[model samples]
Target: MAVHLSEPDRLLPVPGVRLCAVAAGIRYKDRNDLVLMELAPGSECAAVFTRNAFCAAPVHVARDHLAREAPRYLLINAGNANAGTGQPGMHAALACCAAVAEVGHTRPERVLPFSTGVIGEPLPVERITDVLPAAIQGLNPQGWMAAMRAIMTTDTVGKGISEQVALSGGTVTLTGIAKGSGMVHPDMATMLAYVASDARVESGLLQAMLGRCADQSFNVITVDGDTSTNDACVLAATGASGVAVESTEDRDAFEAALLRVCRYLAQAIVRDGEGATKFVTVRVTGARDAREARVVGMTVAQSPLVKTALFASDPNWGRILAAVGRAGLPELDVDAVTIHLGDVRIVVDGGRAPEYTEQAGQRVMDQAEIMMTIDLGGRGHDQAEVYTCDFSYDYVRINAEYRS
Candidate 1:
């Protein structure tokens, strides 16, 4: 079950974006497994892909296409990752892109392809190509929800958000969708996500804004400590609103709204993590730098012992303490460190607090959401937070029988 997460009641559409989904028998037969998103002419796009050395073939194709021209369409399909197939996989991805380009009346370089699902399998190129004409004909501005659902694999609930930010000239709309349950970790970006806005922003500025937003959002989340081979996040600005984000105030407002949308989607992924019962937040403060804080937080968040303890509703402070100690911070002072579970201080001066009790800790652990704070006792003023989930019996079962 998803932890305090639900499908979006409504998704406001961006004016210059049109989307639709078609039933492509690529992997799933009964539902739409392919989605197409069309951007208005002259739209600017920024994307960040998985950094894994063995990334999916679509990742390579998408990167090359985005570099060559302004994207006109984004083709996405679920249930086949198209990774590890080497040259054959690349050929298949290109073939699908070419088909979309031919049908959409655009150059092949104007189409970016993205895929996610079981790795090491050939993408059913014909299955996706056969639906290209249907997908294009069905494109509508209000197809955000359908597009969100079509890109899902193991995700139990659809994740999406819409926000309208008022600028000096006018208001701009931002809508985003994401999909992932497990194999989520920060490597440039965690999962498959797409955010679109009608505001006017250049590609260079949009890329910089996305990088910052991603650092504070997707780059701070982890699930099972595994990054997907097909992880990709895209931010598109259609310039349909005619409100330029050139002024300093306008730029700040746009980026802030973008960050909020990104953060919400990132947390939703953790809340809907596979078999997750608790949404856990690990905050590391007082570190030498922001990077150090994030490293320490992820160390604790990815610890199996700590995650299992969370699943069992066990307040195992020692497990958290051990993970932090091994985080390899330079010249760390154990005696100066402090830790807390919610508002209950569990560790003081690097040991169990005198006022702490098992009952108080258990009370916090029993909740569906938890916050763990570790104060590194450093003089520097840097902090970072990582979002994760507890590991349960179903997590193992889901992955063990995933292929079956």
Candidate 2:
């Protein structure tokens, strides 16, 4: 269970968006496994996808459709990720888009496809297209919550947020939903997410903002340190509110809001990580550059020994220090390093703190949430924070028998 997350009571509806979810029996039974979203005519979108070279077929098709034109429809399914299926998978994804265009009265290129779940399996195009009519016929503005639930594969809770901000001329509302539990070392983004706003935005500017928001949010989180083959984060601006967010001030506010929502969703993924029992935040400060800081933070966050120690509530500071030392920082000053567990200092001047005691560290580790801070003393001002979850026995059991 997630440490501190609950299903949202309500989701603020965004103008120019209609959504619906239905079960097509693709993989799951008696539950929704498919979702369809319709966007307004003037909607503009920006997207960031996984860096995995073996990404799913829908990722390729979605990139192509976005490049050709703004998408009018988003067709997503969970249960069977159309990845590792080679050319046949590409054909299956294209067929699904063509079916959506035929039903929605739009060009095939105006549809973007997304998928998540088990890889190396062929997508059941027939099952998905069979329910397109019902999904389209039942479109409603209040379907965000249902869509959030429908996208789940292993997620323990529905993840979503809604916010309204006053822009230059009017109030613009933003709503977003995400689904992820494992394979969540986001390279460019998370498993699957869609954020839409009713404000008008320039296409190029929206794309740039997405990259910046992702760097501070999704890209910094890890669950099992395994990047999935079907990770995507998309942002859409449907211009139905008549609020033009083009000025510097407006852009900053919008970008900040976007970052907040993305960060919330990213951390929720960690909290609900496969069999996760503890949520951990790893912070690396005083680095020479952002790249090195992230390297150090991620090294600690992804360390199996460190995660295991966290699960066991063990104050094993040595594992963290060893991970930091192996981060490949060529100019790292061992003498200037310091480590802290929450507010309790564990390491000082490259050795155990003279005033530190094991009991103090253990107390911090016993909490449901843990914070580990690593200070690279006397370095340039660069820091990074990475969110992760403790490794537990259920994590192994879940993955080992996943296909069964």
Candidate 3:
């Protein structure tokens, strides 16, 4: 039921990265719930974490470790977010890093820890630490798929992508994986993603690229208008391909490819959203600025009325119009606004278009994928798009019984 999404047939490996997945019994049974990613020495790594004031303990530890030294390994666990446990949570996160360092023969500062799952619970540190040696022993370049599954909590399908971009010197590979289903919104979500490349990139440039790509991808997606404390996105460059992304042309190509992977993963999360029956795209154009456009698009995307209408396959354009009108735009001219559902113009000059018909709107709503465009007249030329999903009966059931 993942809309039009499917698991990747294969994920090409980055030369300087090795991964492994193992069952730690931290939360789930008879399944891998822990993943370890080893990065080559001297690899450049950059990361962005959730801005929530109460971020998870692993986010704090990972940020400190990344600042102190280049990461040699990334330790991740599912089914326990390790957030809201305060000082005790911080110690648990650090203990896991210490265990990884002991087994991998690296400094504790060289390890970054990430966790996702039920919040406000004590992490089973022993469960994860007991499996570190095995995880390291089984590390292989082709463990991308298994790692993707291991890091999932509520995600129904594994989300990942692999691409090869040709530079002037040689071709470099990029592979990324992400997990999320609910508690998703802008400023990051209840998601964790990691992208690795074999191309050589300066540390500063790598961070810049990640921020830009994240703005276009993760930052533009919403599910239920809620953000999580454990959200993070990381980028690692191993330089194993001997391809330098230094030149302007090379930098542009590398960033473009990175954006593609990020966008694909972001959209996949929406397609697999909890109880999602439709993949919805809200595009807001002709705003005063890019930020305004994004704000408006997100407002529409996060509206429960709009989302439930989508789930029911209802051609209720009024829900969308109401959301747009409340987007907090000043001096807004309702008569200048226009809206479209798929290729059908539902609203023109701020009211139902004369040529519009319920049958035509229903035809578009009945599809598994939908696109809604709102034109804010000629206020400006800026535009933005937000990806979301419809809410269904299962969404409520899934969260209501999540702890059970």
Q: What's the TM-score of each model vs. the native?
A: 0.99, 0.99, 0.99
For candidate 2, lDDT tens digit of each residue in 232-327? 999999999999998899999999888888888888888888899999999999999988899999999999999999999999999999999999
Residue 375 error for model 3, in Å?
A: 0.4
lDDT tens digits, residues 1-404, model 1? Answer: 99999999999999999999999988887999999999999899999889999899999999999888899999999999999889999999999989999999989999999998889988889989998999999999999999999999989999999999999989999999999889999984338999999999989999999999999999899889988788899999999999999999999999999999999999999999889999999999998899999999999999999999999999999999999999998889999999999999999887999999999999999999999999998747899999999999999998898861
- Cα miss at 321, model 2 (Å)? 0.4
- Against the true structure, whose lDDT is highest? 3
Error of 1 at 221 (Å): 0.4
Model 3, runs deviating above 4 Å: none
Q: List the residue pairs that clash in candidate 3.
A: none
What total of clashing residue pairs does each candidate reach? 0, 0, 0
Please, what are the lDDT tens digits per residue for candidate 3 over residues 236-299?
9999998999999999999999999999999999999999999999999999999999989999
